[model samples]
Target: MLEIVAVPAFADNYLWLIHDPVSGETVAVDPGDSVPLLAEAERRGWPIGQVWNTHWHPDHSGGNEAVKQAGATVYAPASEAARIPGVDVALKEGDRVRIGEHQAEVWEVPGHTLGHIAYVLRDDGIAFVGDTLFAMGCGRLFEGTPQQMFESLQRIAALPADTRLYCAHEYTLSNARFAAAAEPANDAIAHRLKAVEQARQAGEMTVPTTVAEELQTNVFVRAHDPQDFARLRTSKDTFR
Candidate 1:
């Protein structure tokens, strides 16, 4: 079985650790920092074999050098290989990254960044989507155009309804607030906001949101089309 644990890093970033219990092999994703990640590997007695980065952002690939020193093969999207430091393997869409006995499919999910990608583990029913799709919102268009981002969301929405999203940042509470503003009549979003607030108060994570739940409450996923998505995105950019 594959086990996933969240390693809180930076201010709100989450460095995810996925392991195959039987083989004691682990893969760390979007490691903003290495100290905490390396410590966790030692705590679990698992050898780090793979480090996957969804984008070339510093907060995502900052730990690449340190991880390489620990003997982990770092993989990043082929599009940003030139910008991603210490990338041992550059993967493209449709490429499979084997971890122990399982595999994760690389998907080109640009929008948050020009070369952003998502790693979908079908058998595990989880997808590490980086900043592309958040709990109730989507990433700000930093590199790709709004239309590109809308298409990216559509691709992710095509995944199984049961697919669990493992976003890199902990933005659920704030995103829900925006969702509430965009769809004031959405009782599902209001309910989720309350639940997420409680989870935060208890020092718990509100992540691994199901695709079904996002479809119901997430404005980005529920956007009618590219133009609608662009308008919502523009609103979010200046929400605060």
Candidate 2:
């Protein structure tokens, strides 16, 4: 079986470390910084085998050089080949990547970035959806349009309800607060907000939220149509 661990990087950023105990190999996802990831891998005595990037944001690709120097194969979206540093394998949707005995399917999810991609580990039932779908919200439309983002979220939400969501950032508490403001009467949102607050107060990371939880509490995903989704996106953009 594969084991997944979250390595807290800079404030709010999470670099997921997935390992295969039988093979003693580990792969890191969205390693925003190299020093911390390298140190953590060394601390755990696991050799870094692969580096996966969901997008070309600085915070997501900053550790490319370090990971590459350590002899890890870096995989990024084909559309962002020039943007991502040290991308050895450029993948698109329908592609598959092997991590020891486990494997992940490449899902081309743009909107946060033109070529943002999510890796859905079929065996482990976890989706490493960086910045695309958050706990109670989705990513800002920095590069793609709202329609693109909405479709992306739809694709992600269609995954198995049990699929664990491993997002790049720790925006659960803030997103849940905004969700509560948008849908004050939503029982799931209210319950999640209180639970998230407690988790934060205890210095814990409130992540790995299931697809089912997001569907129930995430306002952006629950929007009826593109128009409503766009309005919500605009409101979130202007929200303080």
Q: Evaluate all candidate structures by whole-model CA lDDT and list the values in order.
A: 0.91, 0.91
Clashing pairs in 1: none
List TM-score per model, in order: 0.98, 0.98
Q: List the lowest-lDDT window of 10 residues for candidate 1.
A: 40-49
Candidate 1 lDDT over 1-240, as tens digits, reads: 789999999999999999998777899998889999999988988778899999999999999889889999999999999988899999999999988888899999989898999999999888999999988888889999989999999999889999999999899888988889999999999999999899999989888888999889999999999999999999988886
Backbone collision count in every prediction? 0, 0
- lDDT, candidate 1, at 45: 83
- Please provide, for model 2 over 1-240, each residue's C-alpha lDDT reduced to its tens digit, 9 standing for 90 to 100: 888888888878999889999888899898889998999889998889999999999899999889889979999999998998999999999999988888899999889899999999877888999999998989999899888998999989998999999998899888888899899999989999999999999998889888999899999989897788899989887776
Error of 1 at 170 (Å): 0.4
| Model 1, C-alpha of 18: deviation from truth (Å) | 0.5
Listed per candidate, the RMSD to the true structure in angstroms reads 0.9, 0.9
